[model samples]
Target: MIAEQPKTNTAASKAMAKPLKRGRACMTCRILKIKCDGVRPICGPCRKNPKEEECEFSDGPTRSRTKVLEETVSRLEARLQELEHPDETTPSVTLHDPYSPYHDSRQLSKHPSTLLMPDSRLFTPLSPFSPTSATSSLPSGRQWTSFGLEAKSDSVTSSGSSSSPHGHHASSPFLGEEEPSFGIIQNLVDNFLPHASEFGFFLNTNRFRHATLLPLPFGHHSRPSRSLLSAVYLWGAHLSQSELLLAQEHTLMIRALQHTATDIMGPHPDAVLHTLQAEVLLAYYLFQTGRFLEAKTHAATAVSLALAAGFHKIRTSNLHPQPMIGLSSETPISLHPPHDNIEEGERINGFWTVLMLHKYLTIALEPPTSVCGTLEAPGTQIDTPWPLDITNYSEGLLHPDVRGSNTIRNFLVNIPEQGYQGQSVLAMNAKAAILFHRSAQLSGQWTPNLQPREFQSFAAVFQSLNRLIETLRHSLTPLAQLDVKNPYTRTIVLTHALTDAATIKLHSIFSYSDSSSKQHCLTSARNMLAFAGFNIQDVGYLNPIIGTLWMTACHVFIDEISRLRSMHTAWPPNTEGSEDELMERLRSGMAVLNTLSDESSLGKYQLTKIQEAFSAI
Candidate 1:
């Protein structure tokens, strides 16, 4: 037996000496920097602490989730610092706590997490390419209760300078006694409130009215935030039909914006939602007043503030049954405010309004300078759900039984019954805008890149767009289509016109020699002209993009007509639209341009271009 044992198994020893290929560490161990025996659903550490369910493992040897989150936090901290101390050369560092004037960079370095709320985990960065997978990392646990930074006191004053510590300059225009009288405030609301929603302004009229009753602490006035109140009155003055109000609209707007600018200098502007609201209204005012750059800047700031407040993510009221290891067993924890339906509805509406504005801005800012864009443009990614109707949300309806989904992305991914619910006018317009954006992107790339992959991609997208158009068309009822008196009529007309514009752009990409593509382009151009032709006077005022759509259609029509004429077809061919019909369409498009030529310099420039093209044909 001893002689047989002496013969060692070298293969077994070698196998034992080899290192084990360990799986990626779970999220819990990665955060704690401890070794993890990787397991499914529950890792070794998470298994011991059942409440650590957020523990997840990567598929490969990639950076752990904790590291990614830490990096994101670091970036955000830098961004916040930059926003607070825009002029970094200034000696007085902006501290979060208004009570304490002393600056301490050491505090931020020692406890960086202090600036982050307990539920900071919810601020997970999402990739545009993998949006669905991005959501998996954002496991809900607790409601975000803290503002994550100290609140600036109203009474605090900065040292070494006459400027107030609340972050206002000594010479701030808001410090003046230029307050609007009660009559002026009432007049402004009367003029603005009725037409506000028509242009995608989502400020709650009831809330504004209530705010007007609250007296300011600093002055004997019946208004809470002077800046916000001024903005309301300013917009009212601009929209006022009264000659007196219109004469002072510019001065009022400048004064209102000056008051709002002071609020921006505060320690943490994003902490207060009302500040964001004021910024948005100001942005809209700037837009209507033809101040594009300033409006865009204000809108961008509002979007950043909204994102900081986590408004892009859908807020739900349901509680997580799995409590953390230390929380009380009897009492459940809530992450969001309970029974605040109005605030929730406002967030929903606000997010979508900004998203739509961003899309409009992008279309406007794109090349070809004559085209006018939407009033407000936010340079931020939008991942919010489609806003429900005001009635449904205001009535305390948490969720509704929709056909397919709630999010705009999901709606596009899987077309809902008849595009979307007919009642949701906002959703309809958003979908149409999405299609138009895709068309613009596709056209931009088509000419430069003639690669096989590009063609294949465009072909696939174009086909999908056609299906979406069909779905949109089916969603509209005969009654809705013809109801010219309804406010929603403008939305419907613009949506259809944009859809046809997108179609024309897509079809125009194909070779002009290709008979089928040329015919499709001609048909789409005709459809766009027809859609925009109805109530042309009203459409121009409803949206600024109508002129661009008309111009695009005219170009397509002219190109097709020129092609047909070159082929020696004297009579109007039955295969294509008649020459007389094409000519009529062209004339109708010109009429719209001529009508809007005096509205702005852009309008006049667009009309000139169209006439030149028409004369050449």
Candidate 2:
């Protein structure tokens, strides 16, 4: 033993004697001027001395101080330059494929031209004093363009006419208090009508087109109200690819808002009905542009108008006539009968559309309070039949034999009703909307420590809603069976996507504790992604509400990724591939959202939120 000890390992002793170097010192150790072994949670010296102050490592600067100073100086220079040469500082707009794989996610997230940019100038409302007030100061011969819209230097007058400074008649008029020129109006109509249904346009398209496109001398009853017409024009400008029309967007918006206010207050044959339509459109427009509070206010107004107009109690031979409740005794009801089946069908569709919008707003905005307490409540009961397509109304294919009261409630409770079965796309969407709202509300009400009775009640409703969602999903027209060329194909695809989204929402609350629930959510999320893929190719514009659905699905993937990462310090070779697959799916979802962001401010907001969430992991 003595002989062995004589041969000491000098290298090992030397290595042990040298102290390990640390990146930074803890605050307490630095203050105490003691040798500190840097460690997370608690350092070695602090651990040895039980009474020592808690160890806290300062979060030092992420970038070098010199680098930060340089960035600050550069930003100041840019600001000074912009102020000195404001006219020359106008940013150039560029167009690119949002879904292209070559584009860097981090770069896109920080792009100055993105809708999420912090510059107030990007979203400034054009002053109502002049149609071109916002664009008037642009340098001559320099044009501002976006979204495939070419720019022009045509000057617009405050009056209802438009002309270039060179005295040339402009192609489009500056929309003012007066009605727009026939060609301008027609162009707006063409841009809006094709995608009308994508929003909540429940009126008959043929009737709307006839009323709007026809010149004056048509009967007042046959023509659209100023409110409705203005709203349509607003949407047209909002959706147009023409820079001329796009320039008038704010003008149209202001005109629409003013007309809607005036028409709702004035006494006209179609005041209540047309204003109702306008309010819905305005609400949707406001929502797409990130005016959530205004959107919610307009939505509530639409609901009130629908109720006042007696749209909730549309009369038919088979349905019992019910007096509207929740109205003050002084409130007057519209007792006049609809002129024809088309008018009557509009009322029916109108109610469903109002209900769907209300529910969607509730889900998307998650307002602190709802207009009507719940879909199943007595005051909110829907007696109107499920909506039939405009074509069905024209063909006299109405569901005259179907009864109405508690229509939505019966469906929710799993009670079979003749009218609720084998429904059309519009009807199915209405049904899905109810289920979607119910599931979201129920999930919010969930608690781990529910009393026995409460638990039982909650379980029963959950099971019923789950079964109904599955049934509705199966009843949907399959994507493969749809005619791709038909415009209605988009509607069908939307319904399917909505159903799948509902399933994920329904199971989301239980996903953490129940494996089956987790799998169900995962399956639904994957299906929604597939639908998104189809939508990207076939559908030109998506309703902004779909952004909520996409966000919900993204949450499912995010939760899954977090769970797998927590399971092991390093992923097993076998499971690593699956984790990468989930990440890919998440990226695909984000790409779809990015594409939507190009057209919608809400989509941009959602995409930014999801990017932040993914980056946190």
Candidate 3:
């Protein structure tokens, strides 16, 4: 019937009906060019990779491995081109510390300090901010050595086979009989370098790197200071927060302080910059670890040392001089044009750092009853210029092109026409702290029996601070393109919080009712709390000043919430929505404080205060 049913065609039909098998490998395996057993939630290969959270999958048409490789190669070539032909004006690599509050997205970076030792899988031969000879001012255009390597011993044994041409013993008195091998010292120094900026110890990154790599001759007076090195280890240990490291922190800190105290009281204290740097580091460590009194005392000591070392004065000479004294203090003796820039930059930064810490301690500590009040030496002035970025000064750019290059007092006396230099985050944060201090002082001067003259003076100071705050806020890089993970974001958040805190402190005493000032205070407090909530974890307990900001915001929120409940308790139900919203915001603030309470006692204390205050209602 019909010619054998057209030969059945069963085989052809079966071939046409068969479907193509989908890929069995997990997405991570596909991307990494490795075998994977397809699994849900997490694949076998991804489980092996520590960054399992980064593994992703899709059930769609995927590009071939060859194509992916080609695209990657293309990107590499383009990046190489850019690096090779970098513009002179634009920095080849904008060096940034991941943990520092000055993180900028535009800049490339190295592995920022973390609580854990750096992951070997993530290690690279050069830092993310690796400089090219043509693009950078580095003397030799050397690539940054990877810092994640384990601290290896380079000590020679009786066999004498351990001798390497590159290895040299940079022994310190603190090391005693067991001199730290080159690798050990390097590891410790690397640990501390990233954190220095965060603590207001502005070191010249390039110079520091160069010096660390190139050993100083034996018996050289300018050998890296043992005190500074010990302090670095202490900070690094504290920051790492490992149980072993935590145990070592006390020993390291005590040793660091011991060495520093000896240096300060020793014959050549004023001639050594490390003494100032070490004292500041000790102060930062103390402050970070909840020793407010000790921090204030050490900071005061550093400030006094800085003044004696001539850090507060800018060194200018008719003829540019050479810095023959290697790694010397920035004194009149070492005042030279070319080599002075880096040292001078450190000086300015160090001075401001001390001042900033002093302000923070002044605010955080209880006055009159506490020893903090005794720490402040009357009439101490910031004569140092606002510091330029270390990179700029490192390249011998003595004066930044920006207009606002004056002493702190002069700049504050007349808020520079240039709203903010924006050239250095260190400078900007310091400025914010200075305004905060002034605002606190103005707030403190208020008394019921104040004379008219005092009232006018305080009012003027308040107005000036307010104006400066507005200008400074305007000048900050817009947050539209901010990376939430960036440290700069924290800096911006802290700046806004401090400015708002100042405003609240200024107006709250004079106007406690539902006036514009009270409303402004409430709004600022809400903003600060919102910011704290968003970035609570990233803002960590390492920063004592951040805790102060959190405490102030919590106090304001609790007070406002209490006021709202009291006011609404007597009023009709019509305003319930507004009160509910206020309650919601207060709840958010309390939640943040609770989250942070685990990190620091200040957080716990503030959280308890808020809870008690709320319970009273």
| lDDT of every predicted structure (CA atoms) | 0.57, 0.70, 0.57
User: TM-score of each candidate?
Assistant: 0.58, 0.69, 0.62
Better of 2 and 3 by lDDT: 2
RMSD of each: 22.2, 22.3, 25.8
Over 4 Å off, model 1:
1-175, 209-227, 264-272, 281-290, 316-339, 368-383, 400-406, 415-423, 478-482, 514-524, 529-540, 561-569, 572-579, 597-602, 612-617
Over 4 Å off, model 3: 1-191, 209-223, 265-271, 315-340, 368-381, 395-397, 400-406, 415-423, 485-487, 532-542, 568-579, 594-596, 600-617
lDDT of 3 at 363: 76
Q: Distance from true position, residue 483, model 1, in Å?
A: 3.0
lDDT (tens digit, per residue) of candidate 1 on 1-617: 55565766999767545642544567667668776766666776777877834566656457657668889999778877777778884433455773232133234424557644442222111111211121121011111111122222333223211121122322222232233334555667777766566455665667757656443321213333546665767777656666556544554555567667664433222214456667777776555444668777887777766665556654422322321212235642222342466666666777767666656556655563232323223432334456656555676454543222235545556634333243476667777777776667666655545688877876787787777766775675433356676656777777777777777766676737677877767776777666533565653255555667788888987876787678856764443476777777888788877776654344566678888987887
Candidate 2 lDDT, 78-168, residue by residue in tens: 8777777878886343347743422332343345465353422222112123333345321112243321111122434333232221213
For model 1, the local distance difference test gives 0.57
**Candidate 2 lDDT score at position 382:** 67
Question: Worst 10-residue stretch by lDDT in candidate 2?
Answer: 119-128
Q: Residue 549 error for model 3, in Å?
A: 0.8
Which has the greatest lDDT? 2
